[model samples]
Target: MNFAIRALRKNEQRVAVLFIMTIYPNKVSASTSPFAFIKDYSGIPREQEILFSTHTVFRVGKIKPTFNYNRLCEVHLTLTDDNDPQLAALTHRMRQELCGSTGWHRLGHLMLKVGEYNQAEELYNELLKKASTDSEKAHIYHQLGCVKDEEGEYKDAALFYEKSLEISRKTLPEDDPSLAAIYTNIGGVYHNVGDYSKALEFYEKARQIKEKALTPNDPSCATSYNNIGSAYYHMLEYIKAVEFYENALEIEEKTLPQNHPLLATSYCNMGSVYKDMGDYLKALEFYEKALKISEKALPPNHPDLATFYGNMGQVYHNISDYPKALEFFKKAHQIKEKALSSNHPSWAAFYNNIGSVYEDMGHYPEALKFYEKALETSEKSLPSNHPELANSYGNIDLATSYGNIGLVYNSMGDYSKALEFYEKGLEITKQASPPNYRGLAASYGNIGLLYRHIGDYSKALEFYDKALKIKEKDLPLDDSDLATSYKDIGSVYHDMGDYIAALEALQNAFQIQQQTLDENDFALSPTYCCFGKIYRGLKDYSRALHYFEKCYTIVQQVLSEKDPALAIIYNNIGDIYRLMGDYETALSFHQKALNIQENVECNPLDCATTYTSYGETYREMKDYSTALIYLQKGLHIREKKLPKHHPDLAVIYHNLAKLYLATQQYNIAMENIQQAMDIAQEKLPLNHQHLLDYRETFEKI
Candidate 1:
């Protein structure tokens, strides 16, 4: 064991996995030799080696880091014989499911089941040459299709499925159950390429044939129902998705054992829909149920078990429970690390999820590191044009990896860098066959946000409108994503100072949230913040404070004390107090905001907000010298992070002008007011409130 460990440790950069098997020969018949001692025949006698049969089965046991190494682990395995009921039952069931005519065919099917796609494809191609009948050829072609589909070669998968279907149709009826399986697989190929409507058409065809030919509660029918539900889920029809998922779950519950992996999968499907619908508690409940069954039915490091953990992590992440989300994500990552190759596509998603948590925590550098890792892994595992890179399922697409990096850059106020990545993602999404509309929408939304930040309101609206139109056509009216689109549009309107339009859009967003999400859900935080900003813009001080406080309360409940969002909320609340002429209270809140902004790894722009707020409060209190200091600090950050003509820069310039005027510095006041006027004229609408205010300040100077 020591020699093995040392030999593997020679590669310092690569992780090493060591499996130690414990076998009891007495558990099996004396004549059935599954493994043999080969130490005596070895040239190096000091190194003991045992050769195991190809079909040897083992029950995985405890796994832990070895030798205090982060990347090395020891996995314990106990050899299982025919006497092990679970192993025997699983083997029998798999053989039944494969249902091949020969041992070689069965082996090929099993290889596909275990994700040995290349081996399965090679085996099936070889078998095809020797096939004696149409039935045999059809089976080989179908198996090849499955292998190609798993490899993300959707065009090949489709062609193979078509070949199999053409052969099978000559002898099989249109409603034949065997034909349903081929139709379902064809639907899967369409689904992989983001053609959900086409996928649904085939899924419904499979369901219809199953309903007519199979027993009502048959597991095969449940599989069809699950596929239909997944299509609806991707189409953002949550109610229809839930209905089909429940139908599948009900059948599975009645037909399968409590710990069956299929039952677990049904629960996971339900959980995912609820998670997307913003029902976090219900999502968590279903996810935990899936986890319970998966733990009992699967090996400790099974990839399916990891999926359950990742689902729970996503629920926690959506609710802003960062630590719990991190814990679950890390658990999933560990399992994948131990079970899969380093370049496996699943690792890209794991890295992306972990990076998202860090990003939300304002750890920009850490977030960028993980996002880049995800991008690198995706590039290594897939072809550049592989549609699976944008799948939005377990796989990570190249576009998604780029978009994630863009999000971190956006948060750090690197707008040009953010735009570069976002455009790259958009270009990829645009190039996808069948035009992956969902990926396109996400890319559009990201670019819209970037344009909004850089003071290009018209461009922001253009991209945002494109995204909204897609959502309006593709998603249910009350889908959370649709609400996000509305909220984003409302925010842009607020920035443009179109108070009535902003209110209308925000009301639409809030109504959808009220219908789909809990009142205190963190998903509502941004809507509340937008409402507060609109109220403040309208000079409704009391209402603005009320809305800001409401946002603050939910954010406090969801995020950590030092969260970047919390600092932003604090700054907003302080600005509300300043508007209400509560100088002392405003300063106190600004102090709190500054404390967090100064200590954490947050964007410099967020720190600038607190500084500007403090400067405004100090100026109102007639402390001109101190106001100048704070305003200069804010100005320095804004100049570094924002575009010269950004609306936010204009606001800060106006504040500096006010401070200089209060101090009777006429020349400096004129210079500052002129700068503010120039930015406002360039970035804002002619009739915008900021532009009007800048005009008045210019007159005074």
Candidate 2:
């Protein structure tokens, strides 16, 4: 006999319970009472039992058992009574069945959904012991993998996922949904660990199966598309990421409800892609769309809402709108604080975002405070050597925290302290299994910058070379990061006065930037400026002016009118005109630069550089009195701001000696020449060209 129990709603307030029982002859007789089993099993009172029948195949057993035993005897019972006790008993039985083996699987899944990772792991492990078939074991293992993944134990999660895949391959048919699911899980682990290439590989594997097995516009397929888009986004393949995100959105728009969370996710992913591509308006449009959907479909304090706010904060930060960025960042932090624990990684991310906003606003102390909070959260939540804490793959949040703190120190002019934190980050990166080349390069670059600022040109060049070598090995030829490496090496070479090497390195960087960057990209401005400086050093005034003009045009388009960066371009142009013997034109440009420096709260060193350039141009034009005035102003500022023995001070003294000699102030010229020689001897190498020039000038005096 077969029995089927179905619940059907007959009206607004009544649920009609239908029981279809098929009985064979000799197996059970109708006169023996089908209702007897229910009475005995459930122990319900006979008066409470209300049953209505639609079909009757059995009489009181006297109607001749004409049907053979093989023939089916079907009985249908419908209970529409609102207060029937038998209905409650049947509902209890159904609930018990649901809480059995099949129910345990659902319970474990619920544990995972609620972030009870340890509990889910325990439940799934216990279920594994009771699994009878390989398919059942595979499902349990897959759930275990999910638990580990949520706990941020990526390596263990990957191993468990692979084990599940192994079992699935052995027991399931080719192209099974189980296989696709395991493949997707494995891809997620790789994605979390910063292996984008491997992530794409596994994602593609899952995608192929899903495309073949599932109908078009399946939500599961949309998930696969979203994963692929995320992998591409992290890889910095922004256009390709957009393609996949659009594919996911197309499926979602067709199959999902207007306010579905998955549709919101698709919108958020699209926003991120536009953000990375520097299309801030488009990014905000998508983010707002996602926010609208989330507000309608999610709780007020949902963590996904926090993500939307943080992303908008990042967009405002990039645009240099500090107050707006802070507003959004704080919004994100508030939501995350309410929804997540202090030690949650999401909380850490929120802290980091807030820190970034403060850093951009030049609030170093506030930035450090929030960055420290992020570090504390990460330390509390993640293991010391966990991939999320530190990994050579350059994706660890801890490494970023260390690097950001170093930047704050550097900006405060604490070079030694900056180096300390930068080296700490580098050490963590070095300890990662594969030694994250990208992280190593970043640390090296930071250390190089500190050395450069302290005037240790050789040490700066050495660190820059280390960074460049790693970038060359790890990045593609046309990658913007690789261009940055070449540009750094070129700038270091320029600082060291190796103009030939500087030209070659800068050219390499320019070519790569031309290939990879947009025509109007601000990143190209520095490279153009460097070219101008190199050409000026080589005495190619026309070529130098050409590059300087290019830099000026770009800077004017990207930055504000009073920006100090534009002052640098004007100063460079002035130097070029002075060298070309166009003294009046040179003075005009120099005056423009000087006016900007005087009007703005400029760096003292930068203001001094303009004064020195003006003095030199006056001396070339034979205006001794005016030259002396500008020279004295430059010397006074340099004396106050620079170390006493700085090579730059020696240059100023040398220039003063030449001016005095030209004016036939023989005694003062000799005195100034000797002072220049002494400072040069102390600060410059014996074989340095500047030292040789000082010696020649001293002999002439």
The Cα local distance difference test for each model comes to 0.84, 0.75
lDDT of 2 by residue, 479-590 (tens): 6777788888888777666788989998998898787466666557788899999988777889999989998887687555665667878998998999999988888988
Clashing pairs in 2: 392-436
Per-residue CA lDDT of candidate 1, range 366-482, in tens?
A: 999999999898777655564452344323277898999999998788988998999888887777655667788999999999899988898999999999999888777777888
Residue 27 lDDT, candidate 1, scale 0-100: 78
TM-score, model 1 to reference:
0.80
State how far residue 17 of model 2 sits from its true place (Å). 45
In the predicted model 1, the residue pairs found to clash are 389-397
